[model samples]
Target chain A: MNKKYNLAVVGTNFIVPRFIDAAERSGYFHLHSIVSRKTQSGLCFRSANGYDSDVVIHENIADMLNDDKVDVVYLASPNAIHFPQAAACIKAGKHVIVEKPMTSNTRELLSLIALAKANNVLLMDAMKSLLCPNFSILVDNLSRVGRIRQCTSTYSKISSRYQGYLDGNNPNTFNRMLSNGSVMDLGVYCIHPFVHLFGSPEQVHAYADLLDSGVDAAGIVILKYPQFHVNITHSKTCATTNSSEIQGEDGTIVIDNISTLTSLKFVDKKGEETEISAPQDPNSIFYIAQHLGETISSGLKESAVNTHALSTKVLTVLDEVRRQTGVRFPADDR
Target chain B: MNKKYNLAVVGTNFIVPRFIDAAERSGYFHLHSIVSRKTQSGLCFRSANGYDSDVVIHENIADMLNDDKVDVVYLASPNAIHFPQAAACIKAGKHVIVEKPMTSNTRELLSLIALAKANNVLLMDAMKSLLCPNFSILVDNLSRVGRIRQCTSTYSKISSRYQGYLDGNNPNTFNRMLSNGSVMDLGVYCIHPFVHLFGSPEQVHAYADLLDSGVDAAGIVILKYPQFHVNITHSKTCATTNSSEIQGEDGTIVIDNISTLTSLKFVDKKGEETEISAPQDPNSIFYIAQHLGETISSGLKESAVNTHALSTKVLTVLDEVRRQTGVRFPADDR
Candidate 1:
């Protein structure tokens, strides 16, 4: 009999359908349950994908994690809820995959990691970015640049919602209590990629433009490594950028888009450049599914790509950035 | 008889010869004196292009400004001295043309502006970018895209001297106390073009990558206006970037090099791009010299290209950015 791991997906919204699609295509995992904060979201999740009725639907984390049929918990909730939901899953003996900006702050994430380890549960930060084939290629090829002198990464999206925020119509994204600004949202993407390439920085300095609600609408952060430095910036109320560029002693490596896996190029100091492309995956969730399957099947304690420790480090940087900029979410307070 | 204005040029480094060349070429202004802080620099200034001994050499600002032979003060000193020099010139009944980052801070500039107004003397920020013919063309054609939306400007130079700073050479260009860093050095070039075209930003937020000595090695900042935003970035100890881009409601105006004032293009919403290359002058200093001649001849109270208030505004923003990033220049205390 082919072993089928039962997977439970939580918080069905902008990303949930894609996750479900990838899970369905994987065939290694059985899509078992869908959980949302409300019944309508669960129905929307089901209707959007025409999901099988065999899958359970739960409105609350306690009910969902308590269900024995669910072996893996994927908490793709709001910026504020990742920690509590993931901890609850770990306590209930389910492997956890929480979305990026894993917890509102470092302290919350540390507590969750402690609980997960104590319970012997596999906890991953669902940062599929580090797991992408293209990213792996870039990291492998980074040494071609000889020695990295500096790197600059930018991720900016022109949010229609920001226009609404300015008009006082919709303000959740601008709200400090939701951790719904550019740094926590987009800048987090820049942080992990740089951290994955060059370990935690020796010194970190950030300058964020605060919104009316005291959250960062846009921000730039510098991570000073031993040999070089990484300059990262993100803005919710702006438009596109050249993703990320790593400049070194010999050449430069540029990734067109960091938010999603895309193309990259290595340009040598002599101006010789080589392009590296990723085998296209229609759904962004493919990497996460593959990582989870490999981690479980190989009996590996955890996938190094999204290890708990790396998540903790990223969370620590986030905590310091928030402290410096004075951005806070309810979960951070918790 | 053609009215001739007498000018005193300060600082004898890279830009002094260019200013002297322009002044000598112009029939409107006669180079009266060349003041150098060091005797060696004064001799170098005299030997350059065979400048005559009649050009008075003063070692100090008080002596240069007090000299009745000098009618206008052309300051090319390090960033730290621009404020005091301009203030002293305004006090001494001479017009002033101080180099970029007009002063270290806004308060110093405000005081100078008051003094200039009281003395009925012309004061201008000698920004080559604002008066460039190519920039004027860009500004005139910017509104063709209807209403403006977004902009990204970058001015970066890979300074071998910054490497010297890393080697602990302590060059004035990398000096933290002189307000010398990537942003002030390069980003001021980026800001002049953007601000001249789009006008002052309603809000400004900066993200600076501070070097070991507390200078911004590289940084990115966003200038928020009413309808859209402008992104400005620079790095002295890093790679380079394109000059500037102004995106509008219908299209985007991309300038190949704002500093050089080279090629330009208008890309519309449907992706039709119209490239327009402006006539380039081998010597980029011609535009400023022409402006200086016209402004002085017409007895204009302020320069149209580089106005006093606009220069003051830019200095104020730089001050706030330094304050937030803890970039305390030696001049700040003075």
Candidate 2:
């Protein structure tokens, strides 16, 4: 607690500033710098996040890394650039936090993890759900349902940018080059909690509604295990009841929302329902940032929560989904 | 309305009595005879369904077929015997109503339809969902959801007999010899409406959790259409919220129960929700019986609602599901 880690954030996407805010509020991190592709964007991101005159601004990763004060680099850039940027930070011996879907494919993710290990820097995926306390509550209550029979995790919501894509405009969300399809953007949330709770499945069967741009508008990915089946339903072009469920022989667990573990309950065979308390904290990133700061202080080389192995399995499922559905990405296999 | 057709009812399963009551209530059919493998069971079913002493009880299909007064034969027998039994009735010039999942596989269904055509008799599947007033209400409101993007229909319920099977007893529900399983017993309800509303998809990807008895306990079938995707999620090992949903570019239609369709509503992008009126009738067979009686009275050889084409498509999807999941049946390919 006596020593605060200096943090520098890249990318001015909406999530970046919010992550920085949470990181600073955790009190283990001081926002030392802001990095952006353009000078004005860096300033805008700085002021929008309420950074005063003392916060340094850098136009490039090289400039930020050259000044060694940034003890941890948070890469929240577009998916295509995540690997290269995270690699640069790890090579510079700075602890790294790569945003959800740490890389476009398994190969890239594994390569980045190897690089982080070679450099002895703490590397982790900013998959917040597992790091949050509510997720633990859900996992802990899994035994009440008896033997698992099947589970379904759905994270389908109409994206704000979909209207533009329909109106003859190209949105990054529907673009294959950015690796921002429904599965990558929303389905990863489904895959993580699913794989984390029940390890990797024995097989995967997947299908997606491909946009003209070759990215999935929506999709269903079924994971097959020896004892049960898990269905991960994700979409960007539509909205649904969007609750995730775990079905068992004796009862069922219903999760109100997936990305944010808002509230969960168990309904036994006799139809008795008990609500399990879960924080409705709108900011999932705050939990991830706190966990990341603690890990950095603890001097770990990788996150024990969002382990490299968990991220690998999640991206492995994503890889199979894109393979089956033909949602190709530029960063795939690179 | 004055001419009540003599209806011969087969199968003593729980759904059989409900169907008989509905058929009699429709006022277009009079219970003439009851058929079962056992004489006491046939008499028991006849008395339990309120059939008078004058209503004859037969212990075999041939005796029921031989009764010249039997105007129509309703086959609710085990799935494996549906095709053979329906063929016997159609050949005897009796109008026929085959229960949901008219046959074990697509091939058997097609063969029975062709035989019915040659015999010049009315033959139809009693897929009650398409025949119900609530289903019509749902179809009428489909346009309110805008251009469809994805749809998911789930029909999952733990069977009452599941406990007996789990306790080292081989219940008929989990038996492959009788062509009984979760997908056949429950998932057919999910697929019938999905195929009816959206037609057959261009491709299919299916998976199931197979029991030691070589039948599915739970499964998912993904139907891929050019414009959208339809997921037919079904189970019998567990229970779920079990709602059906249609996602469109602008809105979504949510059906509370798929088979019975207790209620439905449309929720638009603006979060404005409108409830669609649908009868909460537990007896879906009532609608099917009323429609079947009307169709037979109209002298139609096939149901205009649960058309030959719809049944063919539905059975085809079920076939693929069983094939993919390795849940084979004694009635398959016959």
Candidate 3:
């Protein structure tokens, strides 16, 4: 018999409704509750998203963590709150699928991992791209390109609220106090695919154009590996073509977006183009939700795909880049 | 009356024939002579490229400079030899068109500029992209994009001889001792376009993956300006998509092959794609040759388009990037 996992979500921002849709779409998971500072909005969000009337609406993290029916906590909160909120859920013996970046720094992430392990609960960073069916095809087809030599990933979109910031309003996306910068918000998308394709880099060099708030508005990060190099560029002040290229000696892989692994094209040395697509649902989060359900049902405490070690490595690289570029958050003081 | 310029090319390599073709194609210039270490090969090259039978084949630079009929010395020498060769031509009171990476560093370039001024001869760095008619349109269209925010230029082609280097032959392109690396050979195409568009950057941060020959096999350079950032990636070990993107608040300009500037597409914020193509000769070098012809005939000591100031700025950025990445050449010591 298949076990149905009850899921609760923390944070009610633009991503919360998407999580609710993903949870409801995955047959093995139930959207049980949502934690938001505004309980009325959470209730409204649940009703709008077609969640049952019985779905719990908690006004705070404590009330949500105290709920005994929640088996997994989906965290899509601000960067600064990820650690403490995920830790509370782990301490409560709940599995977790925290959003990208997972925490502000590597240390907090490590602590959360330790707590999750002590309680024997699955803890996975929701890097939805890795769970996409096309990612495996990319990994498998890498050899066709021969030895990997160079990779470039670009993920830039003008934040809808960026104009407000340019006009002297402070938005959380550009606020260092909120632990948000171009790197934390957009760079993680570029970094994850890089770290996934190639393990930890030997060195990381980053340069940025800082916003008035002293956070990176746009930047480039160079990851040096033993034989190949990767260039990752991200920005919130501008929109990019949103294409990425991985060059190997024999062929190259062109990806349309790092956020979603939907469109892929492979060009060989002779310039023959082949489109590579995999079957998957449009909502990428649904795949991750399904993966989490299977892993927890099988009594596994970690995902083999988005492993703890990979998350740690990605966070370590991000931490060093932030340190080099002078992007500091209040949580770094601890 | 139009003054016809007689051109004498120094060094007989792959690019020498192209210069011959451009000179022949441009009605204002004549290919009068060729200089090569092996005079027989120069004779063969002149004959093969359909040069006049009367074209003089000189065995040395001094002989070519002494030919009073040679009004311009087109230098296509090895990287380490560009400084002294161009300097000799300037001292001999002849206008010169030196190939890219005009000199190993900015100091030598400045010295050549001073010499050109003292001799009152036009000196231009043969960066073909700047002379391309399409480039001017890009510069003109910059306002449509609004305030520039981020730019990326990639020019990577796997050297046909790279396999020879991997199999243990140090070709001139990979040999650090000969003042060769990915930056000098390939990155100049990326750097020249960036400098031509943005002037000089306020700061440069570079990271390279060095080969066993102690030269950068590939790298990324971040050029920081007050309001925006530019990312340049170049490689000799692998081929790239060979495209560039300049993003502004209102639109973007996509360039195909920064080396040639053949195809350009302008996309506005509304996602309307407009292809902007300018009329140019099949051989892009024809534009630079004609520009040099007009500048010299007008008694100017430098080109207003590919100015000495612009070449100096480009070399300055390249030198700093080389210094930061530890790409040392024997010429740097002198």
Tell me, by TM-score, which candidate is best: 2
Off by over 4 Å in 2: none
The sequence of per-residue lDDT tens digits that candidate 3 reaches over residues A1-334 is 4667888998878887787777767777888888888988888887777778998999988898888998999999888989988888888888889998899999999998989889888899898888888888888888888887789998877888888898888987788887898888888888987887778888888877788898888888888888777898888877776478898778788888888888888988777889986766888888888788788888899998899999999999989989998888899998
Docking class of 2: medium
Per-residue lDDT of candidate 2, residues A1-334 (tens digit): 5379999989888888789778877888988888888989888877876787788888999999988788999988888888899999998989989988899999999999899889999999998888777788888899988888889889888999999998978987788888889999998998898888889988887888888888888888888888888987889988897578999988999888788788888988877889995664467788988888788878788788899999999999889988988888878745
Highest DockQ, which number?
A: 2
Per-residue CA lDDT of model 1 for A306-334, tens digit only, reads 87778878888888888776777777655
- Candidate 3: segments with Cα more than 4 A from true spot: A167-169, B167-169
Candidate closer to the true structure by TM-score (higher is better), 1 or 2 = 2
Question: DockQ score for model 2, please?
Answer: 0.68
Q: lDDT winner among the candidates? A: 2
What TM-score does each prediction get for chain A alone?
0.94, 0.97, 0.97
Order of candidates by TM-score, top first? 2, 3, 1
The superposed Cα distance between candidate 3 and the true structure at residue B216, in angstroms, equals 2.2
Q: Give one digit per residue, the lDDT tens place, for model 2 in B1-334.
A: 4579999988888988898889888889888888989999888877776779998889999998988999999998889899899989988999999887899988889899999999999988887777778787888898888888888888778889889988879988898999999989988888888888768878777888888888898888888887888887788888887578998888999988777777888999876888886554577789888888889888889888889999999999888888888988878755
TM-score against native, each model: 0.74, 0.95, 0.95
Q: Candidate 3 residues B1-334, lDDT tens each?
A: 4677888999887888887778766777888888988988988988787778899999999998888888998989888899999989989988889999899889889998998888888888898898899988988887888878899888878888798898898788888877788988888898888887777888888878788898888888888888887898898887776478898777788898888889888988767889997867878988888788778778788898888899999999889989988998888898
Least accurate 10 contiguous residues by lDDT in model 1 chain A: A234-243
